[model samples]
Target: MVPGPVSNDRLGASNGRSSPKPRILVPEKVSPDGLALLASDFDVDSRPGGLSPQELIDLIPSYHGLIVRSETKVTAAVLAAGTSLRVVARAGVGVDNIDVEAATAQGIIVVNSPAGNIVAAAEHTVALLLATARNIGRADRTFKDGKWERGKLVGVEVGRKTLGIIGLGKVGMKVARMAVGLGMKVLAVDPYASADVARQASVELVPGLADLLPVVDFLTIHTPLLASTLDLLGEAEFQRMKKTARVLNVARGGVYNEAALLKALDEGWIAGAGLDVFTKEPPEEGSVAAQLARHEKVVSTPHLGASTVEAQENVSLDVCSQVLLILRGGLPTAAVNAPLILPEEYRKLQPFVKLIEKMGGLYTQHYVGARGGMVGGRKFELVYQGELAGINNTRPLFAALVKGLVSSISDSGGRDVNIVNAALIAREKGIVINEVHTRENSGSTYASLVTLRSYDTDPAAAGKEERGAEQIIEGYVSGKTVYISKLDRFTASFTPEGTLLILHNYDEPGKIGGVGMVLGRRGVNIEWMQVASLEKGDQGDKGLELSKVDSAVAGMEAHGSNTKGRGNEALMILGVGGVVGKEVLQDLTGEEGILDVSLIRL
Candidate 1:
């Protein structure tokens, strides 16, 4: 059937057609309610099933817009088929499978229903948790198998269990509230969330994982799988968890280490695990996920958390609304990956990105050493992923995140900066700036992750290869201290305020005990400690090379204000029986094994 043509001006200014209603194609099944609304004003077609990628490639060129669910793979090839397409709408949050870059480059707006299924997803996580804890699915299977042995299917109750939620945003907070309603004690671990917010949700909020591990009975993970969060729950972390504790992971796979988890479950280090995601998809029979599914103690599901009928309808409605808005030239509101500052602000921020890239260059020049030549010339590559993808001024936002990160490293002691001058200055110093953007909604904030990479030299200097070297630096803006997230090779470490301890030790047994003993004697407390070996992952680089520790130690030094009196103060205190003096603090902060001290004030 030939769809009706659009009006003259509505055909798009470039096409120069007369008054026309935009033609839309729902290539996949959408909410009937949403379709009813779209049909009122749009030339709507709902052919949503059994279409091959080739069929979609053949059909999309005729429509002005396309809407779809997970059944479609909107790859670059598929996008190329949409010659007249003005918008692509995803009826759900994640756009990972879509070729967003291709659409954006074609000036086609992409829209998603980010808010519609949030509560649904959150509730699903809770359901999965309860099911996992109480052996609900196992019990159902047993009953279906002609078994009436209820006594053998004993399970735990949600009531009175301490639930640890990793991310305290919408999904995490909703789960927290629901868990509270079920009489579970909810504890949240989110650095971004204020304590008052958790309290308002009737949950206790802890600042870090160290504080959360020993207390919870059931641990439910909701944090996104970012560089910092990948393998977040690993062998070391699982080892710290209480032996009686059970784990539930309904968020993204890879956020937890599947191998480590297998070890944990197999060794009985943990009571059991409930997983809806795995590092691998559609795992083979007898795979760890499959084995877990067969295990009486463990519970597993096929990623059904976001598959409810209500969730489907809500997401369709939400996506349809956003599609209409985008077709009318409006930006998306539920964009999950990047936050778009106003155009005026974006224009104001572009130059700063160049400035920041240059500052990254500066850090590379000094700490990155000879191999740091990758950032020496040409433009630095900055990837802007997330909410930034939905905006018309996405490039500018990319520039802003980069510039914001870079300006943070300079000793300029100034605030206002312009892109015009930033580029000029960067160019004068032979700096190049390039960027790429992508996005998704991971039940966290519509966030932006900007990864800065050097332009030339060896490619290995980009991610994990560049670890030990200090990739980021701290600079004073006003009087407050700010944290800059940097990647030293594969590891991401942050410097938070407190105290600094510097320790140098050989790779030997009892080093940790020795360090602890020294600190204990001087009355200095150790809140948390982490040790990284540069050669641990690179077995080829061990013993002879000290690795990134020297650079990491130096980077920590750059963040602290220089202390004045050390030895002299210690002597003075010792002269008067020496309570609370250098011996104690030095023993606490600067003992032989103490690499650094970061005192926690609160």
Candidate 2:
């Protein structure tokens, strides 16, 4: 019998005691190779033409999985209608058409093949660059119109020319390699990538656009479109480039300002431009993009960067594998949101995952300070203790930790860090990671504990007096809630959520109230507060009064103190609401007896 849409009722009744086979619906055309692979184990229904939004909503509730290409929009209405949908698989990268937030909120996994089009995009970038530089498009049009004006087709050679790349990601790195093979000097600017990574790619790493624009003969952008990158090349940036420089953008639309680019082209700020993507696809007739496409100095394509047969096949197969794995009760490597942890393990370890992520975020934010640049050559160590150490799959937790750590340092264009690319990005930034699992509790009060530590490779680089100072944070799961148990030597407990203010101050009575006053003045509400004194030991209030005396501070001097030999130190962890500005932080730090204050949002 020809497979038709299977309803949830039919599926549930198929096996009285056993689970039914997952039914997958493919509304858009995919490679036969991918379809055949899914057909082997699933009830596959393949339809080449996509369905309308209403049609999709009507048919979606029957199936367990839905796969599509760019043509189909996974709207929130459709997601809400998919009563049985476990996954929404996109055949290619850039899930602009998918409402990923809605899918994630509905507990439906969204997977995309990010690596499938890297080479295709890179080749297209180089192709467009060479075409623009050599006036290939104009020459072809003139020749087809029966004209032989060789003099008017004078062009520049790419050999030995400097190419500045905006982002050194997968596609950008491939472009760099291809440019180098053509004997071009490559310079790149990526905030997340280290100098070591740039050297490995044989490219010079510039700190930002200002440093990269003036020196290069060609500029290419490969960054995703977001608030930070939208209209990245504006009038000011275009003016910074050499008048003869060329521009290429094959990564995303809206990254280059259409108005600014047209102005640059018309004003002769740049010689030419090659574009494979635009702010609006199929730009309106008589629009700026349409006019630019017809310009003699511009060569444009209809978003054909991933049009190769190999790229389509690769993405189709890649997303198909992920869908099958997720349906079969396995974790997908390229999941765009949180991991699909096993039900039992997820119930037990979900809070722990959140706790560790917050801890990692808190440590990185505190270590890097407000300037927000990565410390060079650092190492991240994760230690899992007690019953948490024996979990069969710890990859998800590691990815969560790395995600939090990297997200704190880099601008990810609003994209989430996931298991597939977290470790890869960490390696790109020259971070060495080590993981340890032990059955012992490690002298912790809780049953399970996770500790994260970050340190610099060079001892002197970490600090002057405190050489090799490591930022350590430990947490544990208790029942349904997660608490940060210890930070450095101070012991306290607070739920790892929302915004937090950690203060190191003199062990005096008025310090806590002083902090409260500053936050209150700033209109920030304190939800919870925990204070631990290093000099007071773990004896609670009695130890506090005892350590208040000056000579008694000497007895507890073994515990580390920020102000050594002067007095005992107190640590306050405050859960706060609303924004805590630098001015408020400065006020808190300026308060008497307040030594240091660090704020983090998780």
Candidate 3:
């Protein structure tokens, strides 16, 4: 029975903040009992059914948690619109309906109830296996029409049959166990499963599909629809299987190549198939799936692998509890994309964590243009030096850097991107991270320092220097305080905070006054300013892996030969009181010798 909603306060955060309850949006129908659990402590809006794509996008902007079923398509657009969304929960095992890559990119945790519907789906697969092998659907149709066709409705015996299971996961394992109990010999092809585990289940492990396909009397695919599993069983595979072998697919759509399966059915490559899913749901009119469903030798169900009432109830409750945990700043039992970090480790890494993100933001806003960014597919290479290099894990710091990079470019909440999912999000955006650690410090004022270098995907032409990689932001964390000491070719000293206006220009007269004039007219105050290149030389630049000479040469080539050296150019780091608008920025840029102007908030 479904439980009723209860009143409660907000969840207690790991950071010790008693923030208001997280709002959960169930765009698709889930069990009321599961919703009741969410309602007890958090706010839940269980919509009657799935909404249109646009409807979900429009409604997701303010939601922190989104619970969905198979019906809801959590596309990239919908995830982007969810500015405050922290987690997305699927009430079933497969999250193919959710844009997991997009969700991860925005640092949103994606969780699913892997165990809830396992038994039901496993049972359904067996049912379809029996039904198709015996032509039960055709017999039922003929019998319902008041026709007797006893001689034509011949069936095969399940006992002593050879069954090949493609995946040995929860549902697949359950199906294998059931098949073994029926006196069937089972062969599995899962690299993750060991020989001991398969032996425990009374199943034999095959080296590959080639070894299993030719021998089995029945082939059942239970793998998820991933890049590797997409079109896993096709024409070639079908031809290799036994002529009388039947097929079963209760896993996901597109797992078996639809066109190949249809051709196999028509050409008698295999006896028949039992399909519960299609590449396109509802099997559109005149579509391949539609034709496959109507085949005489095939048994079809409307993707009812988990349609039982018990399955629905179990999934809903399981998914809700997972959502509840994430909303309360806790990790779920089955998170698809979330960083696993101990609380002690997180605390130990906290100081550097905050510093790294600021460095990412600073690098983007301050040095990207100056370095003539030649990014290699939005790549960032981090070189951790000195004491910090000895730490076991550096994922949290890297994730923080990604969070900073993303937030610097958009109005999206920085909090939306965190250590939990930032790395996954970065990958979806084609962002690459290469990290190097050096326990020995070559020579530096600070005992520990981190350098974040950014570059795009495409490599530069022959003999051309990748300027983006040459440009880096160097920073350090002292206790809990973070400070940026270097930017590109400039020796900058500032605490990353508020909004900063970076001005690049030749070391000509009136450059500072020109910026002051624009700000003065616009009523934006210049609280403080630090001018680099005016100093004689940088002792800190010595012994660093990245030399400053290359940048000097690049800058000279970019400018004219008339500029002598460091004194010829200057980078002014200005602490601004207010945001400089487009007009004001243009005004500043129009000033003589003002090479570039960028405003970034940190």
Using TM-score, give the best candidate's number. 2
- Candidate 2 clashes between residue pairs 3 or more apart in a chain or in different chains: none
Mind giving the per-residue lDDT tens digits that candidate 2 earns over 196-241? 6678879998777889999999999987774346788889999999
Residues 266-357, candidate 1: write the lDDT tens digits.
88888877877776677778786666666776777888768788988888888777677657766555432222333455444433333343
Q: How do the predictions measure up, each by TM-score? A: 0.60, 0.72, 0.55
Q: Rank the candidates by lDDT, best first.
A: 2, 3, 1
Q: How many clashes does each candidate structure show, in the order listed?
A: 44, 0, 9
- Any runs in candidate 2 off by more than 4 Å, and if so which? 1-21, 194-197, 285-295, 338-340, 359-372, 375-377, 383-393, 406-430, 436-451, 458-602
Q: How high is the CA lDDT of each candidate model?
A: 0.56, 0.76, 0.74
Model 3 residue pairs with clashes: 105-425, 375-455, 375-456, 375-457, 376-455, 376-456, 376-457, 377-456, 377-457
- The residue ranges of model 1 lying beyond 4 angstroms of the native Cα positions read 1-19, 336-349, 353-602
TM-score of 2: 0.72
Tens digits of per-residue lDDT, candidate 3, 243-307, equal 89999998878989999999998898899999999998899999999999998899999989989
Give the deviation of candidate 1 from the true structure as CA RMSD: 17.0
Residue 360, candidate 3: C-alpha displacement in angstroms:
26
Report the lDDT of model 1 for residue 110.
Answer: 64
